[model samples]
Target: MEHPILFISIILEKLGLPVPHGFVGNGLLEQLCAPYMTYTWLVMVFLFVVSKMTLGNLEMVPGGGQNFWEILIGGLDDFFVENMGREMADALFPMLTTFALYIAVGNLIGLIPGFMSPTSNLNTTLALTIIVWVTHHVIGFRAHGFNYYKHFIGPMWWLIPLMLPIELISNVARLLSLSIRLFGNIMAKETLLGILFMLAGAFFAPLPIMMLGVLVSLVQAMVFVLLAVVYCAQAQEHAH
Candidate 1:
C-alpha cells in the first residue's frame, strides 16, 4: 500500500485544494495549510476541550491529561522565562507557545495513519520563515524606532554598502536553510521507511525508521523554536 498520508494529499489535490508539490511544481498548498490550519485547528480544539475540563474546576493539583498538559505548559513557561526574560517573554508567550505547540503536534501526528506533517513541505516552512522574518524586523523597529536599520551598518557609517548586502544575504539564507532542512529530513524519512518496508516486508524493519522519525520530529521543532528565540532576542537587543 502507498503511504496513507501521501494518498490523502493526492485526494486533496484532486479536490482542488492546495498541497505541497515539493520541488516538483505548484498546487501543494495543503503542506502549509495542514500544519498551520487543519492540524492547528485540531490542536486548538483539543486544547479547548482540555481547558474546559481541567480549568472547569479550580484545582491546586492536576491529574491525568490535565496534569500532562500543565507540566508541558509549565516547562514552556520556564523556557520563555529563561530565554526571553520576563517582560518580553510575557509579551511574546502567546505567539511562541502557539508556534511550538502547533509544530510539535504536527510532527507527532504524522506518526498516525493517514496524516502528513505540513512542516515537511518546503512552502509551508518558507511561509513560516517569512513570518519569522517579518516578525523580527517589525519587533525590532517597534522597539528601536528607525535606528533598527543600523544593525546593517556594522557600527560604522562607511560600511553600509557592504553590510547591507551581507546582512541581506544572511537573512535570505536563513529562509532557504529553514525550508530545505525541514523538507529534506521529512521527505527522506518517508522514503527510507518505504524502502525498508519493501526490503524486509516485516513490521520490525520499519520500527527503527519510526524511532528516527520521532527524533527528526523533535529536532525540527527545536530548531524552529531556537531560531525564533534568537530572532526575538535580536529584536529585543535592538530595542535596548
Candidate 2:
C-alpha cells in the first residue's frame, strides 16, 4: 500500500519538490524526499524553538518552564551517575540527554493527528544507533587508549581465533538490535493506532490506544537510553 503523504510532503510538493508517497523508494531522491526526513526536521526545529523559549529567560527564582527543566536535568544527571559513575555521566550527560529528549519527542509526536513519528523510520533509528555505537567506542578508546582493542581479544591467546569473530559479530549485533527494536516498536505503535483510528473513526475510540502509545513512547525511549548507558559503561570496563 502507498504510504499516506504527510502535510509537510504536500507543502514540499507545492514548492516543486515532490516526495514519493511510498515508504521505500530509489536513491538519493528517496532519502531526501522521504516523509520521515521532513518529520525529523520538524522535530529538530520544534526542539530548537522550545529549548530557546524555555532557556531564554533564566531567572534566579524559577517559574514553570525553568522549574520543569531543572527537575528534568537534575533527574537525568542523577540517573546517569547511578548507572555509569559520576565521571562518565558528567562527560556524557549532554549527549545522552539530547538523545533521550529527541527520541521521546519523536515517538510521542506521532500520537498527534496530522503528524508522524520519525522514530518509526528505519533510517532515523539506524542513524541514532550508529551514533550510540560510535559514542561508546569513542568513550572506550579515550578511557583505555590502545588497550581498548584488548576487550575484543580473548583472555587467553589461543582462544583469540575463536573469540575474535564472535566478539566482532556481537558488537555488530548491537547496531541491529538497537535500531530494529526502536523502529519496530514505534512503527508497530503507529500502525496499530492508524488501524484503530480507521476502524473506529476519530471519536473517543482511539483514546485508549493513544494513552497506551504515550506509555510505549516513554518506555521505549527509556529503554534505548538505558541500553546506551550500559553499552558505554561496558565499553569503559577493563578487559578481564
Cα lDDT for residue 77, model 1? Answer: 82
Query: Where is the poorest 10-residue window by lDDT in model 1?
Result: 21-30
As for candidate 1, its clashing pairs are 18-29, 18-30, 19-28, 19-29, 19-30, 20-28
Give the Å shift of residue 51 in candidate 1: 4.9
For each candidate, the alpha-carbon lDDT, in order, equals 0.71, 0.90
Please provide, for model 1 over 1-240, each residue's C-alpha lDDT reduced to its tens digit, 9 standing for 90 to 100.
343445555666778877654333344554444433455456567667867887787567666767877888898888878887888888888887877776776676666655656666566677777887788888888888888877766657687788889987887788788768876787677667767767784657888778989999888887887788888778769421
**Residue lDDT tens for model 2, 36-139:** 88899899999899888988989999989889999999999999999999999989998999999999999999999778999999989999999999999998
- List where candidate 1 sits over 4 angstroms from the true fold: 1-58
Assess every candidate by TM-score: 0.79, 0.92
Q: Model 2 lDDT vs. the true structure?
A: 0.90
